[model samples]
Target: MAAVAPARRRKRRSVPIGRMLLLGFFLVFVLWPLYWMFNTSIKPSDDYLTVPPVWFPTEPTLVHYKAALFAYRGLDGLINSLIISLSATVLSALLGTLMAYSLARYNTGGQHLSFWVLSQRFLPPIGIVLPVFLIYRGVGLYDTHIGLIIAYTVFT
Candidate 1:
């Protein structure tokens, strides 16, 4: 009984405080870029690129949001982003569910297929930019919203 008690306690010790703290730190680190982007959008560009970098804008303004939403084709970019994100979400969900069902019923690892799909995600935007630029240029879609949508769809 004593030996069994120690084994159970030992299993519970697998996740220690250090691991928890490290995980919390990693989450904060990973999310910091997103937080910074939102923060920048709320702040004036001058304050955004300041020395020491402000953690929180003292005078948070909606000027950037207004500019992005209502000024100079920014709204068009937002709409394009929404369309791309929604399309990718729908496609990925449908494909993932179908693939998962097939794998579950067939008892296949399907790991290589999943790995290849995941590898597509690892590709940086820069990797395909030149090819896309050339293609869009050839097609006379240099600055068109449809071109941007097609480019995003292809990458996804």
Candidate 2:
């Protein structure tokens, strides 16, 4: 015999089990809570205390939303919240843009400033909540719309 030719094989072209598992994990973790919250929000008041915990609501109603929006004056609260949040967001965006431009062009505050600002993200929100609450109370900022705007701006 002179020589023999080997046969070639095609790839399976299939997704790995690990990748599917990871995707499934993300889907469940991210979407399940949101689904449950919306489902619960539309459910009847009795659904809350029901035994076995209704996964899918049997009876859904918008009475709670209507009551809150009209009877409890939630619309006014919503409007106030929107104004405060929008103002804070706009202020932060403008200030952040200016600061970043200055830092990039003039190297303002030297190199350490960037690191210090970045380090704020690492601090736990829970750790500062009590202090912030106390300070807001002492300064008469607590339970005020302006307080919300200030608090949101600081975090931004």
Question: Using Cα atoms with residue i matched to residue i, what is each candidate's TM-score against the true structure?
Answer: 0.44, 0.58
Tens-digit lDDT string for candidate 1 (1-156): 344444443445467889899999999999999998888888867897789888888888998778767886788877777886787667667766887787657746655765776688888989889988998899899887567656655565
**Where does model 2 exceed 4 Å of error?**
1-66
User: For residues 82-110, could you state the per-residue lDDT of candidate 2 as single tens digits?
Assistant: 89989999988998898888878896787
For candidate 1, give the lDDT.
0.77
Candidate 2 shows a clash count of 0
lDDT (CA) per prediction: 0.77, 0.89
Model 1's TM-score against the true structure? 0.44
Which clashing pairs does model 2 show? none
> Residue 104 lDDT in model 1?
57
